[model samples]
Target: MTNNKTILVVGGTGMLGKPVAQQLKVDGFNVRLLARNPEKAQKLLGDGFEIIKGDVDDPAALRSALTGVDGVHISLKGGPTEADFDHMDHIATRDIAQAAKELGVGRVTILSAYAVSEEKADTPESRSKLKGEAALKSSGVPYTIFRASWFMETLPMFVQGKSISLIGNQIHPLHWIAAEDYARMVSKSYQTDETLNKELYIFGPEAFTMGEAMKIYAEYAGVKVAPISIQMLAVLGALTFNTEWKGMAVLMKHYENWGEDGSPDEANHLLGAPATTLKEWCNKRYSQPVNS
Candidate 1:
């Protein structure tokens, strides 16, 4: 039972976006991707998707990719700089919304952080995301904004070779969701009009603090968990000009300041709750034999 609807996925080659694109294909939608590197996307996605060579920065590219698509799913991420966030998260999103509106696209779905709100839009990324959400809302295109919790997939990022560094006093409990579950929900959103023009909060089955989550990951990966202060990370980032370090520091601080907010009741009731646990995700992720 294949649906004839074509869905264009922006950021289809990314960590989260990849799964969403895959799930959309699995659910029988005619999947398309607007990729900056067509060859890379073809390599990553292989055989099924219609890969259009384009970048989000190009309005013409956006318009071209959006043409004739029934729905578009945006899963973009920006950098360690305010300018980067403004350009990618805010401006690019605005451009896409405008193009979708003009092309008469059926629906637009986007992934957003759980804590992103106008009042808590202090950070550059948060502010930009808020603005982007506003852009889609004002564009008169049917949109679904998924405010998602922390992903279990991000745990591997903390591992530096043999050790895992836990940054900041991240005591906030987060409903760490899995990319696979989130992807399924995103695909499901396009199936029904009930999800259109709505903002949904996506949370996992269990809640765990950053430390607790890392502990689980550390044990599974056979690595030691070490604490790193946020200030120290910031200093290290400044000294080395490491954008990833700086970005992590900023993100940890943001989460520490404003923990996960919003209820996942609506999303759960509508699209079914996320069933994957961190331990379960880790087991599957690390199922392959590793060198000791």
Candidate 2:
């Protein structure tokens, strides 16, 4: 149960998880990554990292993965939320916490979002993730919750080919952070014990309204897009499960009117730099090809 390798990365194959695991190894921590699909994990494998298949709900496998892990980094996302209110999101927290405790793991850092208790947990993913945080709090593992803002990379989806939805007049001062900045902070959080047992809000260096974000996208991608509000029954359907980014009710509640409150002290303190805004990230996203 003890070895030089002492970090378990759940969902290491994900866009964020892959970089996080890689950064951990570079920092001289022995890292093990758990993935359900070895093939996906294989594509993202970094030097000196180990991959194991895992199901978060399975108590035994979760415990096995935690063996000798000084802490756990959970990038685990998705769950059975079809009419069940994020079945895995809420349940997996308890399961993960139990496994970590059983394996004697002390610290856990999991990807969380800007979920207020009042926010809409109407879907399986949202509700489940919310519950998972509560479970971790009661699970007895010291934890750092990264209540991250929306990722700038997901902006393309909002365009929807040539058209885009302009809800709230595109005037909502939304906040987003580049995945790279978040990954870097996650690395710093792991190296610094000061972050242990605290939940932090992370966002970009500047707050850009939805309209501004779209303007950046249209300009950078060199595509023409206009804002139109299609407030119909279809919008309601869109809200149920968002195929496009704006459709999600949570996004509407948390973001569309999210406001420009400015950056938190910790956003500058722990990360040592503010998050990269949508405009800044657009430069990174379009200055080169995705494969590059």
Candidate 1: tens digits of C-alpha lDDT, residues 176-279: 99999999999999888999889999999999998998888887788888999999999999899998788878888888898877999999988989999888
Error of 1 at 188 (Å): 0.4
Candidate 2 residue-wise lDDT, 114-208, digit = tens: 64344556545666777788888888888998887667766676666665545445465556778777877887787678888887887777667
Task: Check candidate 1 and list the clashing pairs.
Answer: none
Superposed on all Cα atoms, the candidates' RMSDs to the truth, in angstroms, are 1.7, 4.3
Instruction: List ranges where model 1 is wrong by over 4 Å.
Output: 288-292
Worst 10 residues of 2 by lDDT: 79-88
Query: Following a full C-alpha superposition, what root-mean-square deviation does model 2 have from the true structure?
Result: 4.3
Q: Highest lDDT: give the candidate number.
A: 1
Give the Cα error of residue 74 in candidate 2, in Å.
1.4
What residue runs in model 2 are displaced by over 4 Å at the alpha carbon?
1-5, 79-85, 119-126, 164-170, 228-230, 233-250, 257-263, 288-292
